[model samples]
Target: VLRLYHAKNVYYRIMRQNVLLLERKPEIPPSKRAHTGKVAVGESNQRWCFDGFEFSCDNGEKLRVTFTLDCCDREAIDWAASTGGYDNSTVQDVMLRSVEKRFGDRLPDTPVQWLTDNGSAYTAHETRKFARELNLEPCTTAVSSPQSNGMAERFVKTMKEYYIAFMPKPEVRTALRNLAAAFTHHNENHPHS
Candidate 1:
């Protein structure tokens, strides 16, 4: 009644060849709609988004930064800095703290309707549990589409362009901090629309 394709099967080999020639891969019918990014139509911050970006230290080491932002005002609600030792815990902690900072005693009632992303970090069981504990919804973006998480992606691009890209790599954390401080001033004070 059904056919299965294993590694050594002719069907599998043919499928692999087709995949190599095709730029896009297949998805489940249920996920087909997300491929068009129709899930969170017209959503923005407080309805949050999260992502991790990698950076290189001057010591030739790597670091990861996890950040969360409100979809409405585009404000960075929280962030955490970690090196090669990065994991889901850091992201959960920072996000929870951010929500707490924003809503305080009302944190429980805060409607964080969406934590939108395509990042694996945003899909982790721990991440989901944290969001569930706080009553937030988890949403994934269309596969291979960065535009689904455009706001957070754009913020990252701006930070790298103005701070990281021009700096002397990652050994400049204090300088990076200063740049971030300046950026916060400009981001909140400059009246971006």
Candidate 2:
């Protein structure tokens, strides 16, 4: 096994050297913006970050879960699961649910800033229009910079660690049920200290 491993490493090294000698370096595009560091949340519900997380079930089916987090309290404001893929319609649904959860049926007089990554669904024109109608100021993080939307990213990581990672993998439905329970637990019971 050791001899085979050494032989494989040497072969890959030689192949990499040959490839590098023959291929020219590709040009890279300049980043759209610089890193602006963490976003400060002045108060609860002032700014919300939304993102999509993907998980796989035991049977190899994939599910995309969309969720919104309140920046000030790190609470899971709202979430939705879909096996049909996330698009403008799903994004709109999550936003509407979040708005309703916060302000009931009436829209807030002050628009809340909705921070998210530059996903196609979030960037779609219809989604933008709907957000405006709901009194939300849609804001996208810098291109190629997930850290700009770190709060949501962090919550996704925590969810995977504490909940999704331990879920039984037999069925996507079971995973979804567990995920919903985990989200509720994190929002209502998990301490943020």
Candidate of highest lDDT: 2
Candidate whose TM-score is highest? 2
Clashes of 2: 1
- For all candidates in order, the CA lDDT equals 0.66, 0.85
Per-candidate clash tally: 7, 1
All candidates: CA RMSD (Å):
8.4, 7.2
Clashing pairs in 2: 58-169
Candidate 2 on 1-193: residue-level lDDT in tens? 9999999999889989888545767877765543254655878888889898998888989989888899888888888888878999989999999999999999978989888898999999999999999999988887767788998888888988888898776788788888888988898886553
- Which pairs in model 1 have colliding backbones? 44-71, 44-72, 45-70, 45-71, 45-72, 46-70, 46-71
- What TM-score, over all chains together, does every model reach? 0.70, 0.80
> Residue 55 error for model 2, in Å?
0.8
